[model samples]
Target chain A: MLVSYQTLRARPADAQRQAIRLGEYQSHTAGLGKGCLQANVVITPAAYALDFMRFCQRNPKPCPLIGVSDTGNPDMFTLGADIDIRTDIPAYNIYRYGELADTVPDIRAIWNDDLVAFALGCSFTFEHALLEAGIDVWHISNNSTVPMYRTSIFTVPAGPFRGGSVVSMRMIPSERVDEAVAISSRFPLAHGSPVHIGDPAAIDIADLSRPDWGDPVPMPVTHTPVFWACGVTPQAIIRNAKLPICITHKPGTMLLTEVPDDADVPLFQKS
Target chain B: MLVSYQTLRARPADAQRQAIRLGEYQSHTAGLGKGCLQANVVITPAAYALDFMRFCQRNPKPCPLIGVSDTGNPDMFTLGADIDIRTDIPAYNIYRYGELADTVPDIRAIWNDDLVAFALGCSFTFEHALLEAGIDVWHISNNSTVPMYRTSIFTVPAGPFRGGSVVSMRMIPSERVDEAVAISSRFPLAHGSPVHIGDPAAIDIADLSRPDWGDPVPMPVTHTPVFWACGVTPQAIIRNAKLPICITHKPGTMLLTEVPDDADVPLFQKS
Candidate 1:
């Protein structure tokens, strides 16, 4: 039984819905759990918690924190009432010494006592908002991963976490640029406003179609490629830091949180 | 010799002017370092450093961080070319276990190896911008310390630091309120825009006059009392945390830095 973006968004947080997702129901989470906030998951040892948190704090635009789990605790109650971190996600990406180790469905066996899970805000929330406002999310329109690029903008260094920003690309028609920015600004938890609206090379992305990660979906004829801070920043930082072991959800395989659609997530508020 | 705000603003290094301020020159900081950003100062021991930093990060509106001193170094070179934290401000407030102990010009002799100084953005920069844009700063017109109030807004708790938010008040005529917000929004490092406007009690502030601290300037008949997150929040948090020893500048006395008025602050950057 395959689910669609519209179906997932409409019935996000149906445990049966999510349980089915875990019961050999593997699929990308682009539109799952509609009205429910989906988060990008990153798990690392406690040794890097402080620095990683500082990194997120310093570079909020790219990595807005939604919930941080206590050390060794896999129950992310704050993000989702019944979230069992070990088996909630459909898939996980294991990285060892900055290299891809393996992709697994459930990380229950690998969960450690020193691991801290961070559920960061993802672009799906804002992309939903954009579409609701009649703006086109380039990747979604073409059924692909939003093109992501490494930018020249330097991020504030924190302990072992330091790297340039990673941005996701979206295309907005010229006339609706202001509306795109305005609507997105309301969802700061989701990448906030566009980081760059016009030029691709200006932010150091040499090629538009060639992205560092994720499938690149090109822009339409009448649309401008608008770049936004992406949730992939922490993954990049963790990779660059070369931690002994780190785990993340495969791109597009997000953790569906129980946070309601109209959840009060003010820019700095504890939502 | 006295330095005029206009003349001091034109000077290349504000730390030098601040060094002069330590030498018996007592004057308000407005206009003094026109392009240079000035900040509210709070100095404390390392025991409370992490909590305080967390407090600021959790409640950024009133506590936008500009620079922090290396324990007892007193040299905030990152903020200015030659900032001497120990004697940069014209005035200082010494608090002993949450009680006001003494007010002094400098703490060079009492400086210890465990002290950490924090420089937070003040509302002066944004207020200056508002005034320049033809928006009347009611408190400035009344020659007062922009009315501040202790609101019911609870700051996200961090260790021993927890307290209600303190907001500085300004009365913006309804017509120019949007423009005032726009001008102030650009200076997030300097408290950003108003946290609340129109009513005082809505945020738990009981009285217009008789502020917990600072002067209480009255609002105009047709103007809305716009409130901004204030720098004094950290001071209040430190006081409640009840650290054995803490030091901060007097309400109006601040540490002037060389950061240009337009220098980009890292916290607000999208990428």
Candidate 2:
């Protein structure tokens, strides 16, 4: 059954997750699960889990951890009820030796007792707030992935995980930048405020037309290009480390959580 | 040289840490490191580090991680400059099988490549904010250790780390409770807002006089007992887990970081 944005938006978070789990929906989760928190998923072996968690802790803006699964436990019980990390997301990206090995609908075939899953906050939550505040999120309206670039800003090293921050760019009208910043700042888990504004050269990005990841949208002279630390960062770092195996959610496909977008409390406490 | 509160307050955080490292200071860090962030330290072997990190992530209010040392590395580089986790703190409590085995001024003799150090946010930062807001911190005024209790609030389990939350009690006037909460909420790293406010029995505390740790303060009728999730929570949980070996800072003694109390950025980004 094909799930439309209208139909998915009307359903509760668990039902949305259920559809995704059952393989009824397998597409980008944008505009789906309205008002719910969506997370970037990263699964790794127990050996690398500590360092990955430490990397996230050291670099919170780009890697805000919302939930971490118990080692070898496929169920992310703290993230939401009946959340099986092995199968819930729309799609999975399997990386081996730091390269994209394959993309699959679910990870049940590759599931192992030593794997640990992490749920990181994504920009979808704060993007909803921006739109609600009457701020234009250019890429959303243009139907393109938010442009992302590798910046010169180096993330603090944790074990073998270390890399420059990957940032998502949004061009906001000059008059509304502050308002957008304030609204986005409220969702620190969602990459928070802009790390760089106006000048791409300041952060060592040479060109606005080309991005390291995602599609670039039209940049208007009346607007300022704002860059926020992107959740894709960890993936880049993980790839650099050349780990034996790692699994992550495909870009734009996120795990929709029962947690409200504005929840201040940790997800585990809520359950 | 005996470092008085007045003299220590005038010195920078690194200097204060140096004094502690040199054995010139060996008391509670309560009044020291004014305007800087203080942390509760916990060191465990690499085998237990992942679960401990998960436990802290699961129970953030009580275990707000300020810095995590690279596995087998004693220097908490992200937290501050020249932070030798081995000897920077005033005192250390070595626990064997979760039993307090010794109290030492430093852990240099036992430091090994397998140990992972974690610096968690302590109440001192928020306490300072509370005091700045003109709120009376009863324990500080009385020169007593803040009374802490094991509440019925069970922390979300992570591996072997699971126990009820241990909370520190502060008597705030009934009218000022809201103000105190608002002030402390600004410092999420410092245990944030009170977990429980008025009645103690609701959280399963039988008496006000008896505390599991720290000294009991005189309760006044004019003030209501406010409880904030305490960092001692991890210690309690660690003790319950009975790990083969663990090390923690003595109660009241804390690691002072170069990060300012008002800084919202992750500690790693600062240096």
Candidate 3:
């Protein structure tokens, strides 16, 4: 059932967290956080904030920065009225030396003043735009994660970060490709437009059936595989960098911010 | 006489010291720097580089970043094969603590490693795109600087930086506004699209006739003033920050880089 705009708007950031906080709704926030902007979270020591911020800036397609918390501060007011970085997210992925250490619902116990939390715009925000445009998102239809892949296209390197671009694949029907691109392009804060269309091999993906992460959806004969720069990229990259302590939202889990879906940032509305 | 491409190509960055480097040919480089991308330059201490870079990222349309040299490094290889930040720009404006100190042809003597240079994509790059689409940039026709203004839009604050957006205005026939927007949006690396289309006061400009900078051109009865985020924004922002040391190119002067005018950066080519 589709939620009414009034219903969605009535749910505050804290109210949306109630179900998750009480363990009644710890699942993915795909549809529950309706109309509010969701984000890919990354918390790292201030020593790495500069480089990581640069990395995000350099590769905005995969890491569209929406907000940055003050050093060691858990609040992300820029993203919302009172976003608590420590406990607002439904789940957190702890990484040590670029490897996943554990998955937890919150990081209150580990939160520190040296840590700066970055809220990067996520595709979930744009998926709403797509759905509104009456475009079918394969993963949404299948009730599964979007198939993602490691591509040969390397992102512009910054400091110790160097890796091939990672893309999330969506099978949009041929006629809808233009519409999909047009709508997604409006949300530059959320990856913004397809990186590759038609032949996947051109970008170095050997097989469409075998994605690097998440499940692959069968491509319909009428559909074309539209690839978008994925938010998962930074997790893969910072992991490879082997930072001593880094925290990110676990895949499928995200940090919901108070930024309205209609946030008037021109960059988000480009084209 | 126009310098032949063959002669300009063989000339090395180190050998090209002034406007005469292009074989005594100095005609505003409007079409002369073909293939060689030109950039707006801003130099500041490392302490301010991060904030300025953040400011640029936040205000991309007005200050789209192309490259940032490593702290104290004069040779920004990413922008050009051997371009020196200190002398590549044909002219420079030295500002000290929020005031213009001098307009100099070169700053080699004052160059230091503690200083960082930022290369921002210029509207000149996207003007090529607009021209290709058959849009007339009025200033180009009249051979005058594009009219600019300080608007009511305030940029997001970072550290000591805060100021209204500085926009360059263009008059386009009402019928061509869509084409102008579609063509320019392809060059997000430059100022992507018109920030405002119809009314001047919509963005806080009281009178279009009296522009804050550049010569104002009359809008034909059938034309509309299409405003675009201008590269002069960073210069205005850095000036407002009142940093002890800041360097920027003169209004018409810019740093020429090796990024081909036709360089296939996917972001600029999309759509």
Best by lDDT: 2
Residue-pair clashes, model 2: 0
Query: What TM-score does chain A reach in every model?
Result: 0.90, 0.93, 0.89
Clashes per candidate, residues 3 or more apart or on different chains: 6, 0, 3
lDDT by residue (A102-200, candidate 1, tens digit) is 998889889999898887888888878888887767667666677778898788776677888888887789888899889878766677787788888
Model 2: pairs clashing at backbone N, Cα or C within 3 Å: none
Worst 10 residues of 3 chain A by lDDT: A262-271
lDDT of 3 by residue, B1-271 (tens): 5554345435664343344433343334344365456777888887776667667756777777777776778877666556777766656789999888998767888998789888877777778777767888877666666788888776776667779888888888889889988877767777777788888888889999998767889779898888888888776776678999899887655677767665534222212
Per-candidate interface DockQ score: 0.16, 0.80, 0.21
Which of the predicted structures, 1 or 3, would earn the higher TM-score when compared with the native?
3
Once fitted onto the true fold, the runs of candidate 2 whose alpha carbons sit more than 4 angstroms away are A1-7, A10-12, A268-271, B1-12, B268-271
Q: Which of 1 and 2 is ahead in TM-score?
A: 2
Chain B TM-score, one value per candidate, order as shown: 0.89, 0.95, 0.86
DockQ leader: 2
How much lDDT does candidate 1 score?
0.74
Per-model TM-score, in order, reads 0.76, 0.96, 0.79
Model 1 DockQ vs. reference: 0.16
**CAPRI quality level assigned to candidate 2 from its DockQ score:** high
Lowest summed lDDT window (length 10), candidate 3 chain B: B262-271
Residue-wise lDDT of candidate 2 within A1-271, one digit each (tens)? Answer: 7686556757887688888998877677766677768899999998889999999999998999989998888989887767898889998999999999999989999999989999999998899988888888877776567788888887988878998998989899999999888888888878888888889999989898998877877888999998899888878888889999999998878898877787776473343
| RMSD values, in order shown | 5.1, 1.8, 5.5
